[model samples]
Target: MPRLPAPLTLPPGHDAAGATGPDPAAARDRYRALRRRRRTETATAWAFVAPSVAVIVGLAILPVIWSLLLSFQADDLVTPSRWVGLDNYRALRQDPHFSQAVGNTLKYTAMYVPLSMLLGLGLALALNRKVRFVGLYRTLFFVPFVISATAQGVLFSFILDPQFGAANSVLHHLGISQQGFLTDPGQALLVLVAISLWSGTGFCMVVYLAALQDVPASLIEAARLDGAGRRHLLRHVVLPTLAPVNVFLLVWQLIESLQVFDLVYVTTKGGPLGSTTVVVYFVWQQAFQNFTAGYGAASAYVLAVALFVIAAGARALRRRDAGSPEGAAR
Candidate 1:
């Protein structure tokens, strides 16, 4: 077959011969086309972003607003809803159960957050040092974090069994008496808090490890030269440097501890006279067990507002407490 004729090639003189690349007129046209194409691209990008914005507003923001409105209404699970303006809030203020749940939540936070943070920091410091099987130790510590809360709860439920528990058995071996861990109303909450600390500390340890690695060795050496011992360095140099991380861990731990439901539900079912009943569990009970959707929504919105206020306060405090790098390093 005969080959087709070669397409025409432009002559060298068709364009410029100087330092400038293209003809000025052609360059201007090309620039205009590029600007137009960029405008189109920007518009397309905004179009894509708009869908996500809409989705977030629909799924998150709208539901939150509706729940806030519902909280003020007198809507029972069985009855058709009618707005009764602030009754739910008034009821919550009067409800002993709400107060009790809040108290339990606070107790859990007070117990879990400090214990978890301290233990996590200590383990991280130890693991961060150059030691044998450091990787293995880190992995072992982190394994509990990987386990599901429900699974952990179930495991602990068996272990904390008052009559035939592994823990009680070990206590007996150590010449200690059996104690009610998840059964006694007075001690049930503490057991749950302890379980939370045990499981959560490893995750916080990983965070501290990262922050510790980021701390400058030069600063550590300078402190050492200034005759600062390990404890002094930790309190003066290391702790200050890790303040941001600590604040982050604190807020997260507080929020998670406050909302603890799954483990409590699985282990105690808010039993022994509702001693381990947290705010989230209260909400869950209202929504599912009691079938009071409006009440549940109310509880959730109230908790959300409380969280917002606390988080804002914590952030402000953190900003005020934060020192300049010079101060921290010194």
Candidate 2:
């Protein structure tokens, strides 16, 4: 074996580190320069973000905090506001109308969420294939989502009108009796649910389609090679892959359904007999129409808390599911 070269030694006051290493004084200067650079970068980052942070604090956080304070007071948007802590909350439990609104909101959420998911998933699946006119079909479906809720309400009102409506005329042609869809209390809420599904499913379909497209073709081909049919592939591959998107849509649709107001406001106005009165609409009526700001704030705060709990629970379930054996396998 060849002999290695002897190690080099440095002169006094010089360290034997490497060519890349600077002298102590130079090293300290570099370190200070780096620290200054980092400080500048951080300051620049905060300067860029400050405007957005200020806007959010002013517009969103402040209002929520104010609303919380108002919830503990008695105010009608007029006269002197009186502090009546917990009274508004207590009144909520005993209010029959509030209870009814809660029931209606639950019913709407139950009907709307599943139907929207099913319809959106079905449409996404159908459109995911390499079919002609697919762009046109997607555009047509998404058009309804672009239209304002007020406009949709007006259009649906004409369609579901008992007398001289297109729907009734079509029913008449088929020799079927005319159904009072929006008029009858029994059918009104369901009719509203149907309208909402129609209006909103396009957005859900778009989201699902994007998620579906992100699925790896190689994985799907592998599954097919293993004798997997369409149902098997969907069950084992597609659904598992789309689990995160599904959770997101589930939570989003639930929240949206809970806050349903525009369609109900434009069409039913809390309806023929308060049958279609949802929590959000009820809050609107209390705060604006009935001039009970404090009680309305209390109601809104309760809803906010409920929504927070639901979101937290959903996120926990998602985390749990992600850590499961089946999720890992997928």
Candidate 3:
């Protein structure tokens, strides 16, 4: 109390900001620091990702762009490529083998997508219960999916060989004629579909199983309480819950079916005739085997367009569904 000087007073936050605002110099320095920090962070992030970006561009993006260019040119890999503008694409329309390949590809996709999804869904439903060795059953089912494409082809080829296959041996034992499964052009495509279903259904089954885990048990119980039977519960409660996953599966399998090649490569090689000549196999046969690289590139581009369309459509549908009232309710 020895006559200390009075404390200087300012309005509420004015002590911190002065009468007008925070110190301009301080504010500018703070802004500069923030900008510097952000720049450093962005540079660091780019540095980390540059290698990956380079790899993707070098491998995937550049190849895609190159192939698109190749589609417009006639090149047999041996001769110098010539710019034919739309000739390669035009040739595709009149080329009988190309037409057959497209038809075969569409046929395979039509058969494979629905059948594989159906069988997979059934298996998934069956496996969605509490049972002994359920994990083992799931593992066995998924094993086929993990098997390499080459191995799958080899395994199936031996199993379905018209002459010395175990399947034929069984037919012989049963006193039935040994069917020309992979050998005959008529049965070859169908047989390929079966093999694909055998391998590809596992992936669908696993995806369905995972989706099933997310289905509302409460919804199921409520449906059952309200006089719902097995089919009704599935149709009304379970299936609706699974719509998004179903869309995903459909698009994914459609793309895969369109690009099917490896099994066709090893087993059929486009067939005894040209039966199993799917779009990808057709591309390989033309580009590498038949040495019509431009035509192959064109076919490949057609498939690429189809796949892009399907994926884009599915995405649009999903976005629309997500904006709907039902999606929000879910």
Clash counts for all predictions: 0, 0, 0
Q: What is the lDDT of residue 260 in candidate 3?
A: 88
- RMSD to the hidden true structure, all candidates: 6.8, 4.9, 2.8
Candidate 3 lDDT over 1-330, as tens digits, reads 599899977754365546655677878999999999999999999999999999999999999999999999989999899999999899889999988999999999999999999999999999999999999999999998898788988998999988889999999999998899999889999988998888899999999999999998888889888999998988988999999999999999998888888988999899888888888988988999889888899999988898889989998999999999998787
**TM-scores for candidates 1 onward, in order:** 0.83, 0.85, 0.91
Q: Which 10 successive residues of model 1 have the least lDDT summed?
A: 12-21
Candidate 2 Cα outliers beyond 4 Å, as residue runs: 1-47
State how far residue 7 of model 3 sits from its true place (Å). Answer: 6.4
Let me know the TM-score candidate 3 reaches against the reference structure.
0.91
| lDDT, model 3 | 0.91
Error of 3 at 195 (Å): 1.1
Candidate 1 residue lDDT tens string, 99-172: 88989999989999999999999999999998999999999998999899999999999999999889999999
The candidate, 2 or 3, that scores higher on lDDT is 2
Native-vs-model 1 lDDT? Answer: 0.87
Model 2 lDDT on a 0 to 1 scale: 0.92
Return the clash pairs for model 2, or none.
none
Reference-based lDDT, residue 289, model 2: 97
* Candidate 2 per-residue C-alpha lDDT over 17-125 given as tens digits, one digit per residue, 9 for 90 to 100: 6344446987899999999999999999999999999999999999999999999999999898999999999999999999999999999999999899899999999
